[model samples]
Target: MDITVYRPGELTAADRAAWAHVQSQAVAMGSPQLGNPFLSPGFTFAVAHHHRGVRVAVVREEGEPVAFFPFQRSAAGVGRAIGLGLSDCQGLVHRPGFQWDARELLRACGLAVWEFDHLVEGQKPFEEGATGTYASPVMDVEHGYEAYLGHLRSHSPKFVRTTLAKERKLGRDVGEVRYVHDERDVGALRTLMGWKSAQYRRTGRSDRFARPWIVDLVEHLFHTREESFSGLLSVLYAGDRPIAAHFGMRTPAVLACWFPAYDPQFSKYSPGLVLHLRMAEGAAADGVAHLDLGRGHKEYKESLKTRDLTVSEGWVTRPHPVALGHRARRAPVRALRNAVTAHPVLREPADRFLKRVGRLRAGAR
Candidate 1:
């Protein structure tokens, strides 16, 4: 295999075409991460606009590209899956049957250690290094919106009744309720960001939009329109007033749920839940087979999801002094977090601590 590396923006049209070809082939497989829209070449392009560290490794055989590995390399020779903390799924886009060792590939990319948290299952090369597997909730909507509701109704009847009743009440109390599955309004997008930022601060989580690069990346993606991957902004309105909105990415077949927020004034009506229900309907209408809710546990996800997809959290490293040192530094932190998440008894206190910290932060602000 001949390996060539380039910054995303540096890729020639031919390189992009090759990358897209490999990306398309991978989507043919049933795995969610392999088909994740975030892994598309277009994502790399958008990310590169703000993050200069964005890089792609194109593996070619006889001058024909067969695989595309996107990643971020740090100054210390450590590497991370492209959009590591942000992307719900991560992996190399490769043609079926293409074979290579993960360590050799890491060496080719000049990375001492490569870290990933949402690696797709059955990634043979990285499986041995996986510390744990996580279940990412997904709402399989291939059977259409009503079918999805049927699943929800069967599994969580009260949840469905409550949300739908709230939806009806919202329509009755507010002006005519409206749904925009693929909203093009920039103003609504900005509103979503503001709401999301406020939500993060209130919840004691770092606000991603506070970072200029993330803001730029989202804007770049919003303007990027492609069949394989494109930013999708969905909004719910009540008589010309936006109540809830979401900004995510989607392939022709899969929807990757990203940022979602609602006007806190309408919190009582659960407009965010309404937005997702409509999103599933809209996605199904667009022929998307699944809506990947990403990796995490939330009451809403549990109530709405039809099934779960397994992903891995861990690092892959080649033997090197720097790699060993890096591992030594990260192991304990990773161990602690894993332990906390695995046990509910510990998780409750951890959550409470975070909430208290959030309260302090809000008070300070």
Candidate 2:
């Protein structure tokens, strides 16, 4: 195999066609995880258009592309999954039965350290490098919306009842409730971003929308329309007002849940949960098989997930001082976080503490 690197925009039409072919073949082989829009060429191109240092390592067999590894590199030879902080799914999109030495690939791309979180499972080459693995909750709607609703009703009868009751109350108290699955309105998109930004601030987390590049990338993705990938915005409206909204990415097989937020005044109505329920129904009807809630532990995730998928977090490093230093600094922090998240005893308290800090920060602001 010959490995060559190119900026995301530098790929020729033939190269893109080959890349898409590989991705399609992977999905055809029953690897739906590779169907994440985050791994699609559209996502890489969008990020590359708004950010610098993005590269794709194209591995070719007899000059035919068989694999693509998209990443962002720093001048210090450190690499990260393309759109690292934002992308929920990360991994190389490779043809079946193709394998390469991890270090060799990094060297070919001039990377000393490669870092990733939310890496798709079954990546054997990076398995040993992972410091931790976590369950990413998923909703299986392959059999259709009714089947999934039946599963949820059977498994979470009380949750379903309460959420639905709240939805009824929301409609009665506000106005006629309506849902838009693939909303085209840019205003709704901006409203979702505003709610999401406020949510981040209230939760004492760094607001991603505060960054110009991230905002640009998101808007660019919103306009992206491709066979294998597209940006999706779903909204729930009550009396002509959007009560909740989500901006996520979708492929034919999967709907990757990303940014979701609800109007604070309607918090009692649980609009976010309601929106997800509606999103699943719409996705199933649209022939999407899974709704990936991403790698995180939340009360709502626990209640809504039909099953769990494993995702890993870690770094791959070549034998270089820069690589060693980068791992040394990050490993301990990751270890501590993993330990906390792995046990409910630790996680619950940590969540409470963060909320308290968030309240204090918001009050101060």
TM-score of each: 0.96, 0.97
Q: Give the Cα lDDT of each candidate.
A: 0.87, 0.90
Q: Which candidate leads the pack in TM-score?
A: 2
- List candidate 2 segments past 4 Å from native: none
What tens-digit string does per-residue lDDT give for candidate 2 at 274-307? 9999999999999999999999888999999999
For every model shown, the clashing-pair count is 0, 0
lDDT of 1 by residue, 71-91 (tens): 999888899888878889887
- Report the number of the highest-lDDT candidate: 2
